[model samples]
Target: MTTGQRIAAKRRELDLSQEGLGEALGVSRQSIYKWESDSSLPDVDKLVALSRLFHVSVGWLLGVEEDQEEHISNDLSPAQLKLVEEILSRYQQSSQLTAEQQERVSELVEQKVRESRSPRHRRLRYGAACLALLLVLLAGRSLFARLKELDRQYTDLANSVGNITYSVNSQIGSITSRVEEILKSQNSLVADYATNIQSADLASNTVTFSVRVVPKTYTEGLEILLHADTGDGLVDVPAVPGPGQEFSGQITCPLTDSITLSAVLVDQGTRQTQLLGNYSSLYGSSLPAVGISLLESALLNIPRGEDGLFHVRENYGFLTGLSASVSAVNEDIGQSQVKQVQLGLFRNRALLFWLEPCSRPDNHHGFEKAEQWFHLPSVELDLQEGDELVFAALVTDQYGRQIVTPSLPASRVEGDEITWFSTSFDFPSEPDGWGLAG
Candidate 1:
């Protein structure tokens, strides 16, 4: 049944008039009428109050559960049951009862049951019975007041515990952050010394070392040296002081054979040596390797073929943006330093645009690797059947030597036949390079 029908049924079972329920709920009689008719619903507080007054669960009144009445009659004595039946009958005869009258009848039924079960009350006269009922009522009121106070204290205790827990968690988080910062600072202090191989020239068979002592006060009576293993025995080369906390040393050796080099600091008084950094001549090649490749273009909706080329139709409008990745690696001891990378786009053997110094190596003083992605702006191109698009990168090392990567090409497609374009091209040597105007 609907919520309204359930409310009306429960109200009738208790023989309560609409005005009586409204008065108990502190609402107008029209409100009860509207609720019973389902034209409006009671607020949450009113629903709770109605549930308590009718001695029914709120879930049942809202139709969320099946209506199940509390069976208080099972424990009732014969005389008490008869008294309840008579009371219900008298209310039905009158067709209605006020809220106050209903409450009094319910209390009278409970009092009757309690008095019948009590041995002492069973022998009491009417006057003693009346006095006992008054005492019971007062005791019940005190018990309810105590329960309410206990509930308030429990709420306060729970709130206090929650606040304390929050404060403790906040303090723990702050302490954890401070501890992490302290550990980081200690680790950095432990690694206060650094050393690196600045350059190794195979032609001159010379290797240069760079050392940095972070704590300048600890440099006294300390001699920096470069130890080299040239397939014979260890050779020690003393380092000369440079500006600030820097030191440099160069040693000429036969680098043709794979050699190992290490930088160390020696204690002049105790003759104890501490190793700093080590390098092998075979880490990377002397010449830098550069590459360029076209990444996929999501906007164009074109698929790449097995031959590694983007297949485009003849007279296709190239309005979508394109991007290419350029990478260069030269980790050799001497010429490993990559100064700059230049990228260029070509259409049919002519330069479309060239970006000078499109990318540079990281600023680690001696980094030897670089990679960058160049995003081409959206442009309109009338691509013909024999047209080809190429991307290339020019990598320059520290010694002014430059190397160009092979062209990465995209071909034009007509019907089922694919026309491949030439991947060979020369870079423009103009000072300003090339642009779309060409």
Candidate 2:
């Protein structure tokens, strides 16, 4: 269908009279008639308004798509869409337009419905039509630019997606705990805490969190924090120790996003602080999937620190030597050099199999490579699917001089609810000290 045809169809679907539609779009009834007759086009702003009123997309209203759900406000609630539709239905039922007003509306729809003939283009006013077409083209370019911005916003969020919804988070914590137990890792002397997050339904627009904090050494004034920029800014949820204020027990807070999930203990004597546990990563634009359904997916987050340097951290994951492709923002693609892409596999926190992408000359930066596949097969070592692994996609910028960037952990979700890990990301800069993992 033509753009005008789609608009007419949606207007009818909303039970809006031609006069009503024209009033909503701030256009004359004749303009609506011309649009329906395909004699002229509505400007982009009117198209956007029509789409919003119909709960469809501008592209769909303009016949560019049959249906498109990926709009700028994709994260907006579905209930809002339904509410608009209901309100429109009620308005149509009770709306009372004056007899004179009804007569003022041109019965252009009647002409099309009965005769079913396309409107003849008037030769004298062709210039006006051409001008309208130019405006539409300009509007299309603006829409394209808007789409690019949305892609950048969403892609950045996807890279930072962290572990789990409710079920998935509990499962991962349980499995990681088992791994720690089997590894027999030394007891943490600084700070130790268990993290859990909960949130209300979309209607409530509220989130709740709970964490268990324990203090080993720095006993006095010990506390836990689980907070992040929950769409607004960095919100701190102060969770204190359980009972006896002795640095151990559950701490709860009704705060925002499942942010950095850190444990900090303070010395009562000197007020010194130690970062006991920090499982921090960026999150995707949309709230992540609820549970194991997120398996086999990948996420990356580049949370810039106050000092303007990317902090370094180690990570663990499992790999099957399958199709492993890492993504990141290329600050300066021309000068950027992805020196290495490494996947370190381990069992019970012990390194087992290590893999790296093959190198080619003059091709250190493979951003334009046909494929982003890396394989590391060992003849003497046997690999399992659930083995703990850490992925690091290391890239450096080399202008006339080369500067090393900080290293961060990368992970992926397994296909069958296993072997999932987070994607690693780092800022593109020449760090004074780049302590990359081996």
Candidate 3:
């Protein structure tokens, strides 16, 4: 028979459906169908796997040999063949033997032929054949009963083997499913450990942070840190553990400039930090309500120090050209409102001079704009160490009501030309005192 026909026969013998066989071979039902229809052949590895699954040799599945019985009989000796014939004749004489019994007798003869070919039986082949014929004659009916019992025992053993094989395959499938479940559970746990920022509040110069964590046990030996990038440098603050899985902390810094916040977890054992999340815009406090929109100066060309502060060297003296522009006032105030803008300079919180820029005609229809340029060629103020210089703007409306913008501070280095001029707001302790442009 062809290989496909043989495969079909073996599958039927094992009481396996096409789907069952496909599952055993790790292939789709369509693949099994094609293989059995001879439309496609299994690959070399698949052929080997099939041979092992079916408990058959690869050569037999490939149709390399004829029927198993014929193959066995081809190697039998003449004496062995004669003995098989005699036994068949005796069985045929029994009137009670049915057609099915006759077929079984032939199979028995083939089994005996294979056994007799063993080297131990080769020397007594003819003698054993004669003795077998005599016994068959003497114990005719009794001998037939014994042979039938043997066949029953063989059938029971085959059934037991099939049961054992099925049990093993079931156990293997159960183990595989359990392993997958464990892996899925582990992945779910990892996902639960993700930290999230619950809320961030900015009050004055302090920013308070609130965060949520999963699994209260995870808080043990875990340190949470809040990092703020203040354009100049990074400031790190540790969060104190609160009730349950919550953590909170606060940092004091100017909130005017845009700050980048990052949440991190530090392991107490290894002291290594793991980033949890990041916030680019916090509290929307990056810019003041009304202040310098832009400031340009030649001093900005100096390189910044490692601490993110500009360090002006001695060679570049003070009095470098500077330009400052004031952003439009509140949208409600129209340009038609009478107004005068003055730039005030303060040293050590004391007013030094008020320089007013020449106001251009209000050509723009919406709001008023003010700009001032300073080139202090001969003027030099001996700025001492630790001295702070601040710039403020005074806006007076037609009603004589004056409003002062927030102050910008710059500190002088001990021996350097200038240290740093920060764009952040530094409101004076007594706001009313600084509001007057005397």
Model 1: residue 269 alpha-carbon error in angstroms: 68
TM-score, model 3 to reference = 0.23
Cα error, residue 51 of model 1, in Å, equals 78
The whole-model lDDT of each prediction reads 0.46, 0.37, 0.45
Tens-place lDDT per residue, model 3, 190-301, is 2222323332323233343343333333646777676666664777888776666565665443332245554566666544333333332232211112233222232233
What's each prediction's TM-score? 0.22, 0.21, 0.23
Winner by lDDT: 1
Specify the poorest-scoring 10-residue window by lDDT in model 2.
Answer: 285-294
Q: Cα RMSDs of all predictions?
A: 30.2, 24.2, 34.6
Superposed by TM-score, candidate 2 places the C-alpha of residue 210 at a distance from the truth, in angstroms, of: 0.9
Error of 3 at 28 (Å): 62
lDDT of 1 by residue, 396-435 (tens): 5565544444232234334334443322233332222334
How close to the true structure is residue 321 of candidate 3, measured as C-alpha lDDT? 9
> Runs in model 2 with CA error above 4 Å?
1-192, 201-206, 218-232, 244-258, 269-438
Stretch of 10 with least lDDT, candidate 1? 314-323
Q: 1-438, model 2: which lDDT tens digit per residue? A: 555556655564454545568799899755675565443566655655665677766555554455634243222134533432343234223434345422322132232222322244222122223323333344445444443443443343322221111122223223433543442245564434454444322223333445555555644444444343343455555554556443333333322223344444434444333333322111111121010111112222322245543232322222111112322111111112233333433332344455444333253343332233344342222224343333332332222222221112323223322222432222222222233333
The list of candidate 3 runs beyond 4 A from truth reads 1-338, 356-378, 406-411, 421-425, 429-431, 435-438
